[model samples]
Target chain A: MNLRFQATKARTSSLVLVSPALVLLGLLFFYPILLLFFTTLEGENIGNYAQVVNSGTSMQVFLNTLRIAAIVTVVDLVLAYPLAIYISRLSPAGKAIALFLVLIPLWTSQLVRTYAWMVLLGRQGPINNMLIWLGVIDAPIRLANSEFAVVAGMTHILLPYMLLPIYNSVSKIDNSLFDAARGLGAGAFSTFTRVLVPLSIQGVLAGVSLVLVLSLGVFIMPALLGGGRVPVIALLIEQQAGSFLNWAMAGTLSAILMVIVMITFLIIKFATRMFVRGRIDVAST
Target chain B: MPDLRNTSALKLESIRKTFGRVDALTSINLEVNAGEFLTILGPSGSGKTTLLRLIAGFVTPDSGRLAIFGKDMTMASAGKREIGMVFQHYALFPHLTVLENVMFPLEMRKHSRRDAADKASAALAAVRLDAFGDRYPKQLSGGQQQRVALARAVVFEPKLLLLDEPFSALDRRLRESMQREVKQLQASLNLTTIFITHDQEEALVMSDRIAVIDRGTIQQLGTPNEIYYHPRSITVAQFIGESNILEGTETPEGLRTSSGMLLRRASPSTSGRVLVRPEAIRITREPATGGATNQFKGKIASRTFVGGFTIYQVDVYGGDTLTVRCLADEGSMFEASQEVNLSIREADCRPVPQDAKDAGA
Candidate 1:
């Protein structure tokens, strides 16, 4: 009875410790997801799901989402890995400054930042004006409302999400591991591949997973920058719910997106499991 | 290329390393002969590890040359140095299996995966861990992990093996036994090794010669007997082992102690120090005991019995302390506070340049 009472006390405090995050996830995330799935089953709108998938515009939007997400995730990983590695070499003060600058974009709303790209990449924006002045081009280059602009805007917002986790993971690595690799007859390239990259894979998985998942739901960047050219699932869902008053179709599309996000996450989770377990086995023996 | 295992012939010429403003190693020079176990003996913060790093090529010397078999490798990468090293923490990869860890060097040599695995298995067997080939480093005992480290280092048959206090993490008994095992292995393989240690007794047991380092400089480098019995510095005497010391004063015959005792003659500098070996000092309880060069009297200050021996500290005049070793079988006839006479041969009481402390400890 005494042991059970102690166990109950421990459980209660642990629950209390995580209560705020649990409440937020339940209210803002889980409840909305449940509501979305429930609304898709409403009796009158069964054919609405078929309408979106069958539409030429909706099919294009769906493919665009996968394409853009892949491109952005790859870019994020490539750009972030080098930056994270460079940051790992910095002193504490230097690292703090770099991270502060990297995360500064996160302090602002994504919508406002994407709109700022409007002023910069617009027809008469400084970039085109400079090009015209240099006689590089006779006319204002069409920079805004393109797939390239949308990718740029989304990558700008999501880069920190990729870099910070990788940076944290790289920093925790035992610096002596590098020295050990060198001592074991490994050159610079071999050491980086065998030791640095493999050790920091956990960070890569996390950063890429989060960025890929977040990119799936990015509607504002495509809407503002793609100029109706870069259709994506998020934009289709928005149109179905708002202008079409077809909430059921919207819910169905949301469910499909949710399934994809979960599957991607599960793949990532499995990979991370392999890594953590591999580490544990190595440690015990 | 000549075999590194068969010969020593290592030189660190004017090696220097600076971490910012702090000098980790400064103009350090050392040479070890072939087929010898030379221990770089120093206290922590004495740049001993840094010196190892420079030789291993993990850290480039700011200004110096590291030569193995008299071949200049100062600008060479760590892989190019081809020296085997055992880290203090063992630094075994926590992700790879034991065999995989051992196979890493072969893989670096561009050996096929199958060949690397075969070599790794052989290396594990050499460490007497054949059954543990599939296990990871963490699963092994501390002693076993040390063995795996040893096998991994020598698996490639590199000639210059460097050990950075590899046994410091093991228990005392395990350390001594491992020392014997490593010494036999080195002798059998004829591997030239530069071992670093802070323990004087360990150095005495292992190295053919010892370089006693202090404050980033070599105070003295010689055979264990030469360094112990004929230390040129006060620091060497204290660092090497325990000592009984008295201030030195010049005498007509040679150097004298504070007690007006004339000790044996030794090379004298204008400013000199005297050193002596404890084994050189003779202690006897019988009053008629004579024939030794010098004699003194004291009560047993303390007596502690080791399993095979009894160590007696005799408190002599002028507050000098003398340690007397009596074999277990010989039996200690004196108890604490018992009056005893101590005698040492004049030859054994050879004065150091000064009484760096005492003639005999």
Candidate 2:
């Protein structure tokens, strides 16, 4: 009985130690989510969800969000994979410099980065002028305020998120595995495709998951670079709450996006588990 | 490349390698016969590993020629060299199963899928891991992983096999069994094998001929018996086994040790150290009657029972301690401070050069 009382006292002291952070999180984080959920149910319960799901424009916006996110994720992966590999193979000082370059844009303000892209991708920007000077284009084409602009901006902003995880994974591979592959009669290209690619799948998956989710929920990049031509779920949700003053529709859209994000997270988690199973979970003998 | 079955499997001519300011290998000239099991043995930081990498075509020699099966391959890339190597950590692909790993070399050679599977399974069976072909590398124990690595390396039957301290990570019992298994496999396949290791006993047991390396050069290269019984220098003697070297001058009768014991042996050198292995010295409470030529008196300083043999550290009257090993079952036990006599045959007292460079200097 004395031991049990001591255990209770220990538990109580630990709870007291953590209570302040717990209360802060409840007030600032979870409480807002709870209020959002209740706002979706105000005066209409299932009606708001039904209306959002049934509307053709809302459905089209949702599909557009998925398509744009998929494109951005793919573009970021293609750009990040080779760069990550190159950086991971560098010396310590070289790796530091390369990583610093990759992270500079990520550390800058997102609003500033988007606006910078606007200037660069303008009608008479350097890209169009250079194309005209090189005789590739007859005139300055529309570079900004299009689907291409949105994809380009998001890929630039979200690239470091994809590259860092893949770099970490690729760098942890043993150097001797490369030697062994070549010694076993694998040419340079064959060794890379068979050995390096298979071993670094985990990192690729991690980068894909991060870029995909972030691209789906992105709002500002599409609003500015897309010039309201590309309608996405996030942009539509923002308009519902800010311009239309329709709190119910905004809350319901947010809840649907949150559920989709959580589901995507679970699917990626399951895929990661499947890929890394029996490969990395064994004891390091 | 010519398939010269009778030619030397590997030949090195004045090979040297330097990493920036450090000479990793220097003036290495060696030849390996076909189907010969040669081991490069040394302490850590010796040039044995550098030599192996050079032969395997991983590192280019700064100056020298390397030939495998009569083909000068000094500038060849590793993949074109047709050499198979097993790393110390096995280097098995973690994402590939045992079967897939073994099939890798065959697949690289462009074998059909059915043929690769057949050969891969046969290779797995050779390593006694046929039942575990589907399991990944991480799913296997260290010894099993080593077997998988071995299977993968030899699946395509390359021109030469290089093993870089592959058994260093196993437990003692597992290491012994794996050594025997590897040796037997090499013999059966008639594979020309070059093993690199810092382990003396492992080299002695596994290699038909051993090269002892020190300070970026070969100190001595000979058969295991020759290396043990007739070390050319003090460095080789002390590195291979436990030694009690007595530095002294040569006398008409024998060598007079600096420690004041006149060891009865005709010296090969005027003044040098003579090595007497611990097992070569016999200890008894009383000297034997016949053929007790190099007998000396000493008091037992300590005794250690090491399973079948007991090692006694005897403090000789000449003020130097000589380690003596005797069969534990054959003789009476000697306690500390007990008086004893130690005898060594004249053949056992080998005159050795004092330094590694002295052998050729």
DockQ values per model: 0.56, 0.56
- Global lDDT scores for all candidate models: 0.82, 0.89
The per-prediction i-RMS, to one decimal, reads: 1.9, 2.3
lDDT of 1 by residue, B1-361 (tens): 3432334479777778898987787667888887889999999988888888888887788887778887878888888887888888888887777888898887888889998888889878877898988887878889998888888888888868899999999999999889997898789778889899998999998999999876666778999988887777777877887665545676656667766655554344334345555655666777545563567778899988887767788888654777877666545467899988777666665444443334322
Interface RMSD of 2: 2.3
Name the weakest run of 10 consecutive residues (lDDT summed) in model 2 chain B. Answer: B352-361
Give per-residue lDDT, candidate 1, residue B133: 83
TM-scores of chain A in all candidate models = 0.89, 0.92
Candidate 2, residues A1-285, lDDT tens digits: the string is 699999999999999999999999999999999999999999998899999889999989998999999999999888988898899889999999999999899889999999999989998898898999999999899989999999999999999999998999899999999999988889989988999877888889889999999999999999999998989999999999999999989999999998888888899989888877766556443
Docking class of 1: medium
Off by over 4 Å in 2: A1-64, A90-107, A115-150, A224-231, A252-256, A259-263, A277-285, B1-6, B354-361
Candidate 2 lDDT score at position A261: 84
lDDT of 2 by residue, B229-273 (tens): 888878898899899988888877777777788877645654457
Evaluated at residue A243, the lDDT of candidate 1 is 99
Summing lDDT over every window of 10 consecutive residues in candidate 1 chain A, give the lowest-scoring window: A276-285
